[model samples]
Target chain A: MSPRDPSPGAVGLGRRRFLKTATAAGISMALAPLRSAYGQAGAPGDAINVALVGLGAQGRVLMDAMLKIPGVRFVAVCDIWPYARTYGQRYLKKNGFEVRAYENHQDMLEKERDVHAVIVASPDFWHAPITNDCLRAGHHVYCEKMMSNTIEGARSMVRTMKETGKLLQIGHQRRSNPRYLVARNRLLGEAHLLGRITAVNGQWNRAVSADLGWPNHTAMTPELLQRYGFADMHQFRNWRWFKKYGGGPLSDLGAHQIDIFNWFLDTTPSTVIGSGGRDYYEGHEWLDNAMVIYEYRLPDGMARAFYQVQTTTSAGGGYFEQFMGTEGTLRMSENPKYTTINREAAAPPWDPWVSRHFLAPQKAPAKSDDDSSGGSEKVDARETAELAGYYLPVILTKAIHQPHLENFFNAVRGKGALNCPADEAFKSEMAVFKAIEAVESRSLVTCQPSDFTA
Target chain B: MTESTNTQSDCGPTLGVLLLRAWLGVRAVLTGIEKFSDTRTLQVPLLDAAGKPDSSGAVVEVTQKFYSLHSYHAIPDSMKDKFAQEPLLPSLLTTSYYAVLGWALIALGIAVLLGLWTRASLFLMGLLYVSLTVGLILIKQDAGVAWLAIHVALIAVALSLCRHNRFTLTRS
Candidate 1:
């Protein structure tokens, strides 16, 4: 397909419409009174003034949440795009905030003296530079996920964060998610619920068409091409398809799943082995679908874990994790649902002890009044409450991001530890780095401690 | 009257056949270079396991400097190791080979698009692609698989048009 194809135009139009609707809603929300805001008041000594760099889609969402967060004020906004800058300014103005605006983050940091925290929501390539500047400037940071575009960049961020003694929270919000937290507590914390985890399976699958909004065969200027990270701006915008700027699905979506595996298992994979390519999509450079497998060994050496992620024609919406253990299996996802299937405690048919134990008194199995034929069983309120409480604040509540931001603010106030620190982010990034290497090499890629060094 | 009209139409060529003939004529004109140039030979530096140039670190250093000037995915460590073992060309020469090949491919792709020397460019690209693919396969490198696929596809398209040389102008 040529670069000038109309499909991208159609997609862009759809996106623009969505953005228009979102922008209108944001304007209305901003105009609402501060007293009625989600979070409007702060405790004594809890004041946190924040400056946002890169007011893109995710950036605006975080900003909206911050405005609603009590004790937090939006002090400054920065963006390379004029539209984003104007939208952010309007939102802030409506919220009664005299937000200082800048075309660049460096200028914003230099000018905004009262800013206690900076949020780095720029592109993958810009994360390290912006984060380093923010840390060195003595401001706590809440940088978005996929910490950096490269392994070296992630390492440097970690080192700089450590040297500055400032709070640096990596935005892997799933770490703060109540559903995942409950799953973690049940599978990892409770031993009997799922006996010594032997293996883990996880997947995040989605279906997307091949068109990315841009003209095919578009003549690219040297400067424009360089800015886009390639001679093809079409590939640049649809970066997941290219190798220069993005690492395809392995780095984009796989990072989250890998982070979950690492978090629950308390170990990074010993090695990652996988293969993927753009098999279905014609004329696209990036892989449309991929499958990866990672082998992890727990510190105790008692269990092994495996993780996989695929993005292709979706047979169905898939986002779940299965933990296989000796006694029972636990399946969980962000849907706030988990199942524990208990296996009967008995000797195997092949075991010699089965013959010997057969003569012993065989107690009748316990019976329940509830229907057993149906697979679905009602969970007691107390059990559900325990699972829900596993996540900080509560489950089934839209406060995950709020509490995560709250944690960052508390860390800045020296009252709490960061939920996802730079070191942890580096570890997560290392896993992603290995995954990319593994896919490229078609061989198992291992991560050593030295790999984390800047 | 109908018979006379059919006879006249048969005597005169259709636009589709005329275009095909013209395309074949152009393809025949550009194939002259393939007969003269020896394009089968492949040249690449040998590297050892550590990815250091086999002969010395000089080639590796030169390659690194060249890469710094024009950024490409860093040569995989495995490729470096292969270079160390084969050492087909010195580091400077190897770097020059890449520079020349990259420019040549770009030129050829443009030429093919313009239907200027289409056959010659396609043959040259095909040879380069084949040589590179063989070298990578021999060295057990996975880096160039995508490029190999693209080169093969382009060569097939160019070869399929060998019967026609009538070039279509952008406006025409």
Candidate 2:
């Protein structure tokens, strides 16, 4: 008999047959969700009526994420500019949502009084006012962060949320990212994987781009621009660079990462020192490049974080926050490709974590034969081998912003708690305010504990 | 007749052909077998000081390689995605090629080993290596392309020397 033939009366199934069945089962199991969604409606009585108050680029990003969530009905769309207003209305209509379009947010508020939640994605200056009004109107608010251009406006947002007893979720989306949560709650909090983080380095660098311009036919009159606190159509279209309407590159781009520093460190910085200048962009009101160092007082020791935002060059390895500790280093970013963990040579074995499936070991890259620049090996006698990298083994399959929006909408349904609540966000926003102050003063700015309190 | 057969077997070219067949045939069979083999690392939970099984603490054991039909299709999703994007290679064609590749390698490898139609088997094996080289080139894997180029060259040498092949299931 051939080796391939089964013995007589063999009780177990052949390996090939077993594998074929398993493969079929896996494919069927994977497709089950899509099949069921097509056959039925969303969860009963989970309807959430949401109104969007800003229809610009950021607003559209939030809308796209919200569209993927089930049981969310768009009741109204509002923007100050007619072009954005029309674009939002048309886009939502294509997505099967016939929403009321208004050029004034207050007009939409008055008409759509019953919207369960309002997403405030307006310019930084308007975040506090719109969020406060939405809270007062009995709507939960999801406001984008750098919460406001000024500290007082951000404080008012916290005060209003407390007074009105509404959930105010600030859009620091990393707090709700699955990969970040695992790194923070499990690896850092539970396992003590990185053993007393000593320092952090982060940056967001962008190559120079032209000033934003609008279609001449779609330009709003100067009177309307002035009414909305913009100097002219130039300031309105490019509000992010103007001081009156928004913060500079540091506040606009740096806030997202600086907030992560505070959250992961679990403490606000005590001092900030930095310098910045607008040497590159000719007409922009804010600094074109800024570098700031923030010092945090952890319970065990002191930790310092260095952060920079550069609008002129995309040089220093894209955007990521790297935390260096005695035992290891963790580099994290919104992009999963940038997230990685590295062990220090002196640290204890991470074999237990690997066995627990908390980490996946990375295979070393193959050495190239012709790479022969060999001076470093002869110069250092006691040099250690470079540490291997390990992945966190956590994956976020959904769009990055979707989970944060879902967290807010779920909290509105009384099923979950807000990830970045208004009070918590106020504390982080204080650090960003101080960093900008440091840049302007070109000196160290110290913070009092009470200063961060809402 | 027996003396003639003995002389043919002991000749230098016949011995060279025998050694080459042994090396290539073993390599081909093992490569085919590996396509249907896989390994998994499993964690056996460790007990804490209080005698509870700690999910975070465990002993890792790498399982012995086991063969199954599913293992044959364990190509990485990323590679499959790249292949799907290549304009010249349709996904269906790639899929069909992969489905038959392992079995073909094993069958041809056995035929070459037993000296059953040795010349024909060597030529077919060379074609298989050429096809693999094409895939490696499409993926821009320079190292893999180089490795397969060596295999194709060796197969060409083996074909040139296979006229002296003996000790076969069929006379050649």
Candidate 3:
């Protein structure tokens, strides 16, 4: 049948209408608040006073994204390092923003009373404290992910937000990515194109790299390092690999993609088994490579997802999540090139979706040499046609983190709901926390459903 | 055998030349035609669960291929962007070249097919291939350069056997 033809049956027609309605609803629901948030031109009363708490690498990234958003003004910048403080202050000033700089977040809060929202881009160890303090100080917060270095710390941030009745958004930016939203909500959730998903695999691998270095002239004094909970500048700069400051690669990289497993499945893992080692880099306290397997007990049937984060080599197809089912598979990544959907030969035809322009079929495979040469060859009875892939017809042209930050800002303005609220991210973080535990104990860690609750 | 049949069989080189002319002419014409093609999305009414067109005004986007002046200009403008930064290529020259490239390909392709000034058409086609090779080489596109080289080679063979040309737009 031609692509424009409606499906032959009532059920198919029902699905088509439902797909259209749901897609339209989802787009309006997602776009309406964002449009309101972005349309404001920073007029006097509409402007939101904002503060940045950490001016390091992640802090600079968040600052750049927030700068593009409308109706937000930076009033203060804070960081323990004078080097970063200078960078953030200068960068913002160049963008027509002049803000006070401080070496401490509390000091900034005390001086900048009008600040409406604070962005916590500090290290994992400091995320909870900074976010909690900002919330208690009557300011909404947008904190970077791996919510906190510890489960108790993550829970405290959630509890504090509840007590203060403030907005707390976690930086799982993929949660707000339009491409991901369409794939998860429309294709998988509404269309049910991937049939019964039974298995998943994901990875984030990196090539070996040397530790970060700092300018000798900008180095902090020993006394300053001691007060800020760092052994030295090395510990402060390379905090992600240390035990006291971070949860290693699993929390640093795995948290982003693993959170999607929970979000897409709408359930936390029941058990986590892990294996890892800190073998590559010397003086680093955390594992260099970690592999984890999480088992989910859904209402229908059990499913499993395997995840890994390796800092030694980027050999395995960059980073992406693959969901395999009887009908099809979805390979998703923040990188658009790594994302696609493939349908099994046994699955029903997807002409309706193609007709609706929801999915675009890729080029068909060339005929095999045996068939082309007209040679008589017996085909194996078990052989099936190759799975054909379709490209998701969506793309994100802006900075990857911009949408999530916009979502946070909109929530702060009471115009929209937080995409990655503290409570929801806390649940996903529990899986990573347990996977880390499984790594330490070298055993499978079983988690009760209650374990995910903050 | 009949005299007409003998005449046809004796001119094997003419048949070879005809085959090459047809292949090149069709390829060029089709490539030019595709430059005018583009995909446009339109919202169409959706069918409800009962397989009847919905009255709720709900619609889904349907993309269809269209031929228009906008696509013809846009395709060349896109190619100009790719060639913009090549040190050996000037922006003005690239722009002018692209403006006429599609039409020139179609006209030349037809002239060769109809044996209208076949010698001049084949020579200009070869020159076009040569210019494309230079552009591809400057952009460090090895595969495109190789493909253009093969086209130039075919044109060279066709020109060498123009003596066997039997068809023309006017009497010989």
Candidate 4:
């Protein structure tokens, strides 16, 4: 007798298969709108293809961070340095990723048709060419900071992205940091908390020196060196010290603080006046200590922002922002602590009973003026003033980097607008550019939007 | 029999000779353009307070002019500087020579691509390459000089490959 034909459920196979298939189909249907909204969303459970062009310090850190996110696969990597290529490949392989690698970016762009996005962390000189090629090849991009070494390169990059209708997210991580977001919100949203902010001060100080003996050698060949505006290996490796490859401290460190200043003021500075030079460090082409004063005119009035960055000295504590106002002052930083201090009262107290009793109260026989009532009044005033003088608010935030990454991925999926778009980056770049100009010219430099245009 | 033999042996112009002439012609035209183009008059944004163009704007204007002449596209207005600084005649002449050389090169590139004036165009392009390369090197504009070097090398290779004036005005 044929074994009684097992029922579908009893067979433990047909029903389960049907359920699995149904679930997948349902998910695809549910995610259809999301896929349409976001420009590109890979299939469910499919790895998203990505490539990293630069494997420098920051580039490696970004790769580690991207690996933490699910559904990502590093498909290809490119760097002019052979070591960077092998390093990236080994890291990916150790993490179970099968990545093809290329020494040249053009070749990678040509070969990697399935690549959905690319992360560019190459030197400033290569940013424009790599980014333009990536966009033209129809891939989204996450480029590292200081979009390009030159304004022309930056303009060309922006133009290429616009023409190609591609997405580019600059590597300004503070825009993604939750602590900075909280501080930004408090400064802009709580109008009276810091009174009317009339001035701001920002400082970023470090203890780097030319004598530190850091590897200041570049690996470019003589031919390449001549072609790319580098005088030599030292100039290329320590590009931050030169005007050709970088904007020095103003572009390196000042960019972050300047962005914060713009965030707080809700407006860009109309003009920037700057002074300071390479007073401390020797053998460096860029300024070791510099200060820039930016005057931002808001709808209410004008405000001043002073930025001081020093690389030689270690004496540093004000590594934050101080907002000054008529009524109080607010000091804040990314450390999650915000403090405010109210102004002291300008007038002294007067006795109320003297007017009612007589023009002047006759001296009471032997009773002192410092009685309990007067003393209590003084104590109360003191307590009130003390309470009003300072308020410290500590904000608690979960990691913001993950959320920022999530936002970028979501934007790729068409879920939201970019937190920091190219236009905003252009503004930030312009501010930094003007700061450098001011330092170079030794005078005030006005920043118009047109200054950044091609 | 002797007369017929002589007529049969008579050799007209060889392909090598024809190619050399075509190359020379292309070179002359490119050199003329390089000598005649008015690049200094080009305008650019980022003018200094005194109304003179800033360094960045000036460099961009010059580069754009060079590329425009190379690609045969019209120069855009944003590049026009209102404050006309005094012309550097020597520099202007050098720039015009490069411009004409660019057109000539483009014409040669087309001729070579079409196999029309292959040998002559290749030769002319090669000569233009040498002059431009020398000028760029002397000017000490490192970036421009590097690119010019590459172009010169490429033109040299193309010129060497012309067999029998395969494409030349003579052949056309």
Top candidate, metric DockQ? 3
- Candidate 4: misplaced stretches above 4 Å? A1-47, A190-192, A210-231, A337-402, A449-454, B1-172
Interface RMSD of each: 28.6, 8.2, 7.1, 28.0
TM-score of each: 0.55, 0.71, 0.70, 0.56
Q: State which candidate, 3 or 4, has the greater DockQ.
A: 3
Number of the candidate with higher TM-score, 2 or 4: 2
Deviation (Å) of B144 in candidate 2 = 14
Ranking by TM-score: 2, 3, 4, 1
- lDDT per residue, candidate 1, A234-336, as tens digits? 6545655666555667677777777877888777777777777767767666566666777777654545445455556673547766676655455566553
Q: Which one is best on TM-score?
A: 2
lDDT winner between candidates 1 and 4: 4
In TM-score terms, candidate 2 sits at 0.71
Q: Write one digit per residue (lDDT tens) for candidate 3, span B122-150.
A: 89988987988888787677877899888
lDDT, each prediction: 0.60, 0.80, 0.81, 0.62
Q: Candidate 2 chain A vs. true chain A: TM-score? A: 0.88
True contacts kept of 1: 0.00
Best by lDDT: 3
Judged by whole-model lDDT over C-alpha atoms, candidate 1 comes out at: 0.60
What is chain B's TM-score across the candidates, in the order shown?
Answer: 0.45, 0.79, 0.84, 0.41
Better of 3 and 4 by TM-score: 3
- The lDDT, on a scale of 0 to 1, for candidate 3 is 0.81
DockQ of each: 0.00, 0.05, 0.09, 0.00
